[model samples]
Target: MPAPLLSLTWTDHVTGRQGFLVVDRLVRGVCSGGLRMRPGCTLDEVTGLARGMTMKEALHYDPSARYVPLGGAKGGIDCDPRSPEAYGVLVRYLRAMRPYVEHYWTTGEDLGLNQDLVDKAAREAGLVSTIQAVHPLLEDETEARARLADAFAVRVDGLGLDELVGGCGVAEAVLAALDRAGHAHAGARVAVQGLGTMGGATARFLARAGLTVVAVADVRGTIANPAGLDVEALLAARDAHGGVDRAALRPGDRELPGEAWLSTEAEILVPAAVSYAIDEVNQQRITARWIAEAANMPVLPEAENLLAARGVTVLPDVVVNSGTNAWWWWTLFGDIGADPDEAFAHIRRSMRALVERTLGRAAADGTTPRAAAHALVADRLPEIADRFGWYATPRKDAP
Candidate 1:
C-alpha cells in the first residue's frame, strides 16, 4: 500500500471531541471518502479505511482501469452516535475541520453517521452539504441528469444514495458469482449477517432478484426460515425497530443465536456488518459455498485464505461493495444525463464485469479473488502515479 500523503488530528476545545483525517492518496489534488462517528474509532482504523478507499476508488468499476481522478481519504470522530450530544459534537468536529473539508477532503456519512446528521453539520459549518458538487459541474441538459443531481443532493435523508447503490452492486455481484458457480439465482439460498443500512439494502435487492434470503442476522439475533424469510416483512421490521423485530416473526420463522447466521446452510453468504466479522476463530464455521463481502473487510486476511483453500469463492470487499464509491465518482465525473435506472444498470454491469474478471484471474493464477484484486490495483497504481506525477518523492525521515 502507498503511504498517506497527509495525516491530521484535531480536537474541539469546547467539547474535547477528537477526530483524525488520513489522506491515503490524492489524484489531481482532490481526495474523497466518508466521515464515521463511533465510540472507539482509532487513527490506525481510519488510516486503514482510507487505504481501502484508495483501492476501492481505483478498482471500483474495473480493476484494470481507473475511472475517477479522485483519491482516497477518510475521517473518523471518536464519539458515540447514539448519544444526545452527537449533533453538537458533529457540528464542532466539522467546524474544526472546515478548511480541510473545503480545500482537500470531501466526505460523506459512514457507519455511525447518517446523511441528515452530515447535512446538518455541514450546514452548521457553512460548507456544501452535497457529497460532490454535481449541479454546476454537470454539462448535460437532460431531465434525467437534473433528477439525478437533485436526488444526489438530497440523498433521501437517512437511506442515502450510497446505501441504494451499494446494495444494488452487492446483489449484482451475487448474481455474477452464482452464474460462475453454475447455479441459478431464483432458487439459490442466501444468508446475510448484519441488517443495517447496507445489509438491509442488500437483502432487499437480492430478494427482488428472486433469491431466497433464508436467514438474516442483526445485533439482536438471527432469524431463519428454510422456505425463505419474507424480505419485505424483515425490512419493515428493521425500519420500525432498527433491527429484526422478534414480535413481528411469522409462523415458520425461528430465532437462532447471533453467530448462527454464519453456519446456516446456504449457497451464498453476505457479511455486511462490521469489520473482521469472519475472523480466524469463526472461519472454520462458514458453510456457504460463496462469500460476497458487502461490508468493508468483513473477512480477515487469514480467514479469506482458509475459505479459498476450501474452494469457497470469496469476493473481496473492494470489488463487491464498491458501488458507493462508483456512485460518488459518477456523480462527480460521469455523464450527468443518465437516469436512475440507467445509472443503476451501469453499476450492476460494471460490478458483474469485475466479478467475472477477478474470478477468471483467480482461476488462472491459482490465487484468491482478494489477492488477484490487490495485484490488479497494485499493477495499475504505478502507471496512474507516473502519468499524473503523483509519485511521492523519498524523504530522509519517510521510512
Candidate 2:
C-alpha cells in the first residue's frame, strides 16, 4: 500500500489567496519536493509527493537518511503560467507564501514550470539562493532538474555526441554491459524512443560510439533507416525545437508510426519516454537483446518481470537517469562548490560507479539490475537510519 498521509494543511489568506504546504512524510529535518503551478491542483498530490521525498531521500542519500528528515513536500498554485495574468497571480501566491518561501518549502520546477519561472517567483518573494541571502535548508526541484539537464547537455554536447545526457549515460551503461557480456558497440543496431532530451542524447551517443541508430522517434513521428540512419545528418537537419525536419531529410530515411520506433529491429532499445510506455501489450514487439530504461518507471513492474523471464538483460532507470541530479547536489551542497566542468565530471563519476557496481552485482547473482539496485539501497538505508537514531540504540548492562 502507498504510505499514509502524515501532514496536511490549507491556508486562505485575507488577500483571498489560497496557500498551503503538505509535509506528507518527514524523516528528520530535510524535506525535498517540486513546486508546481497549474490548475486543479489538490492537497492530496502535494502530500503524496512530500511523503515520496522522504522516502526518496531515505533511499538516495545514506548520509542524510538519518538526520536530514528529508520529507517529500510539494506546493501547487492553481494557476497557469501560460495565461496572460499568470505572473500577477503567482506574485500574489508567493507573497502569501513568504513564511514558507525561503526555508520550509523549497520550491523547484515541476509540471508547467521551469527554473527561470521559479526564480521569478523567488525574486518576488525575496528568497535568495541557499548561499546568497540565507542558506536554504531544503533544495528546490527546478535546480535539481536543471542541474541534471545541464550536466547531461554540457558533457554530451561537448563530447560532440547527439545523444542527450540521458542517452549518453545509458549508452555508456549499455556499452559497459555489453563489454562485460563480451558484446561490442561497433556495428551494433540501436533503436531509441522519445527523442526528447534523453532519447536524443541516447541516439547520438550510441551512434558516435559506433552503434547504428537504425530507428528513432518522437511524439511527432518516427524515422527508420535499416542500413543505419545518418545520425549526424539527421541531427544537423533537426529543427531548433529538437525535431528532425522531414522536408530536409534524405530518401533512405522514411517516416513511420511513432510506436513503430519502439519495435524496430535492433540489438538495444532505449525507452527514454514516460512510465509504462512499454507494457505487456507491446512487450512482444520488443526485439532488442537488452532494454535500457532512461526514464523514470518507464517499465512497469510486470513488464520488467516479463523481460527478466525472457532473459532480456535490463538496466533500470535509477542506474541510468541520475547523472544530472547527482551533480546538482554535489555542486550546491558539497564542501567544494562545483563549476560547470567539475559538475559534469562529478555526475559522470557517480553514474559510472553506480552503473558498474550494480551491473557487476546483478551479473554475479543472476538477478535483475533493478533488484540489485534495490538491494544496494536496502543494504545502505539501515546503517543511515541507525546512525540517525531512527530506531533506539540498546543500552549495555553495567558490569
Candidate 3:
C-alpha cells in the first residue's frame, strides 16, 4: 500500500497522551472517518484504519445515489476513554487538530469514543461540528445538519439509529452468506466478542433473525450458554461501556476465559471490539465456519491466511462495518431520510448486494474476500477520480 497522504502526531499538553491522524487518500478536498480513544493506540494502527476507511468509501460508491463517498482518514488518541482525564485529553487533542478537522477531516465516533462526546469536545475545541469539514459539500448545510441531527436522535428499542445501522449491516452480511450457503439461520450459533454499540445491536438483530447467540465476550470475560443466551436481557443490562451486568445472567450461563469467545462452538464469530484481537496464535482455536469482522482489522494478515487455509471464511471489515459511515452520508446528503425503517431497509439492501458482489468476485478470482474487496475498491477509485477529479477546486460562490 502507498503511504498515507498526510500524517501527524499530537501530544496532549497536560496529559501527555499521544494522538495520531492519517489521511490515507483524499477525494474532493476532504476525507471521512472517525475518532477513537483507547489506551495503547499507535500511529500504525491509525494508519491501517485510515486505509480501511479508503476501501470502505470506495466500496460504497454509487453514481446514482445522492451520497458521494469521500476519501478516508482517521484519528486516534492513546488514552483509555473510561479515565477521568480522557475527556480533557480529547479536548486538547481536538483543539490541536482543529485546523485539519476544519479543512480536511470529517470524523465521528469509533471504538472507544461516541459521537455525542466527540461533538461536545469539538465544540469545546472551538469547532462548529466534528463533521464541519463536510458541510461545504452539502447542497444546503442547514437542512443537512438538521436531518443528521434528527437521524442521530432516532432510535429502536432504546438504541440509537446511528449505533444500530453498522450492526444491521453486519447482520445482513451474515444472512447473505448463509442464504448463499443454504445454511439455516434457525440453529446457527453465533459467538460475539464485544458487547458495545456494534456487538449489542448485531446480537439483537441476529437473535431476532433466528440465530442462536451462544456466547458474548465483554471486557470482563466470555458469557456462554449452549442453548442461546437471552440477548435482549443482556443488552438491556449493558452498561454504557458495553459490559453486561453479571447479575443479569440467567441460570445455566457459564463464565469462561475472555479468549474463549474464539473457540466457542459456533458457526459464526463476530469480533466487534478491538483490532488485532485474533493473531496467528489465537486463530488456531477458532473453529467457526465464518468470522464476520464488526471491528476494524480484528484479524491480522497471517491469521487470516491460516483461517482461509482451513476453509474458515473471514469477511473483511471494510465491507461488513461500512454501513455506519454510509448511513451518515446517506442521511446528510438526502439519499435517505431520518427514518428508522428507511435506514434499516437501505442498509439491508445495500449490504446484501455488496456481500453478494464481493463473494462472487472472491470465487471468480480465487482470492480471499479481503482481496476481492480491495479489487472492487481499486476498480471504483478511478471512476470516482475521473468524474470528481483528483482534488476539488475552490468554489468562488461562498456560503
The clash numbers for all candidates, in the given order, read: 0, 16, 0
Q: Against the true structure, what is every candidate's RMSD? A: 5.0, 7.2, 1.1
TM-score of each: 0.88, 0.71, 0.98
Which digits, one per residue and each the tens of the lDDT, describe model 3 over residues 1-399? Answer: 789999999987797899999999888888999999999999999999999999999999999999988999999999999999999999999999999999889999999998889889999999999888888888899999999999999979888999899999999999999998999999899999999999998999999999999999999999999999999999999998999999999889999999999999999999999999999999999999999999999999999999999999999999999999999999999999999999999999999999999999999999999999999999999999898877665543454
- Model 3 pairs in collision: none
In terms of TM-score, the best-performing candidate is 3
Worst-scoring 10-residue span by lDDT in model 3: 390-399
User: Where is model 3 more than 4 Å wrong at Cα?
Assistant: 396-399
The residue-by-residue lDDT of candidate 1 on 1-399, one tens digit each, is: 547888888787867878899999876556778898878878888898898888886775333332444678899898888888878888888888787776667688787776667988899988874343322223442543455556565443245555578888999999998888788889789999988777888888899899999999987888999999998777767752247778789999999999999999999999987777898789898888999999777888888888888878888888898887777666555432234576678788889988898888888998888888887788777766775558333322235
TM-score, structure 2 vs. true: 0.71
lDDT of 2: 0.61
What tens-digit string does per-residue lDDT give for candidate 2 at 1-399?
245434444444433434446654433333455566655556665554454444444444635321233444667666555667666666666666666545445556544555556677668767663113113332554554454445434433344221343455677778777777888778988887766556666777678788898888865788898999887676666643357778766788889998897789888888875556788778878878888877555677787788789888778766676543333345445422324445444445556677788888887877898888767766755665665444222322213
Q: Point out the higher-scoring one by lDDT: 1 or 3.
A: 3
Clashes of 2: 16
lDDT on C-alpha atoms for all candidate structures: 0.77, 0.61, 0.94
